[model samples]
Target: MYVPKNFQEPDRDTLFQFVRDNSFALLVTTGDDGIPVATHLPIELLPGPDGKFQLVGHLAKANPQWKLLGRDTPALAVFSGAHSYISSSWYDHVNVPTWNYLSVHVTGRTNLLTADETLAFLRQQVDKYEVHSKHPVSVESMTEDYVRKEMRGIVAFTMEIDSMQGAAKLSQNRDDKNYQNIIAELRQKDDTDANEIATEMAARRVDNGQ
Candidate 1:
């Protein structure tokens, strides 16, 4: 989250889109014993009545992390996008190796959703992903008794986003000569993540009118 001026992504829309693309995020909260607990889950962002973004996700009922959720409790959702290792050799000039990546950190207070609200969220979440399937299965297609029994095994909560910080460290600090070289080398690699970081760097260049 410690983003430098050159790497910081200030656009709210961009950050929200990044979250949507990388919906499976890390949720972090501290316990009473001061130990941090994290859960990896698919969290969706929705607009609230006050025009603010809220993150919604569910955890297994046995997961103790949900116990940390409260109106006053602080929570962090971390969305990690494409990332790749940048070799110093790829740079035209002499430099140390580094990482090029995109990430967004959201901080807010979390509250547990009501049972009815949780069910609605579940149905919506199911539809969101199932739409891509050839044979999509929906919550409404299931028996009411079965759905209710399944819902009882999870806890759903929402975090009203108070702040979001995005970092797009795609070698923006490098000069054009080195930047172009980085992308070229990344594309030559067989790694998908490397190719994605290269694509992002090229897109950023276009955005900056370079």
Candidate 2:
């Protein structure tokens, strides 16, 4: 993630919130052959017993991704949120079209979870996702035998994030006139991505004491 200084998102609170909201992220690792392998996974963010934040996610047992990359290897988790195209016509000055987006990159070491941890991870994920559900389910919803059988079908892993890099390319580099123009143009559209960028831009304006 090559974030320009002008586009770098420095708000630590916003960065973690973005990860939680867009928890379905891409996990990337280099294979033994040095080819990059990637998996699209939904991760649950949790505080470990040791007090460090941990990423909890599972892959299919037959996938072999964990066997190849889950142990003692560097990994990257990419959380991509909203993005949209900014037309040059929306700028006050002559400029080419560009994309505005928000994303977070996490680099860490991955470790396969033990059987006990896998079960615990599943319960936590269900609890987290079903917090608002009327008919919330839990690990106790299934019989012990059934839960064990199901656990055999998946592989769970945890990544303790060592570093996080973030970016939000939201036209902060533009002049006031151009910035307002971009926001107005975005707000005029029905596209969610554009609308999201517009909202962020408006918040940024307030942050800048505009």
Candidate with maximal lDDT: 1
Off by over 4 Å in 2: none
lDDT by residue (tens digit), candidate 2, 103-165: 999889988889888888888788888889999888878755688789999989888888888
Candidate 1 residue-wise lDDT, 120-210, digit = tens:
8988899999999999998889965688899888999999888999999998888898899999999999999999999989988988899
Candidate 1 — which residues are off by over 4 angstroms? none
Report backbone clashes per prediction: 0, 0
**Model 1 whole-model lDDT (C-alpha atoms):** 0.91
lDDT scores for all predictions? 0.91, 0.87
Candidate 2: worst-modelled 10 consecutive residues by lDDT: 64-73
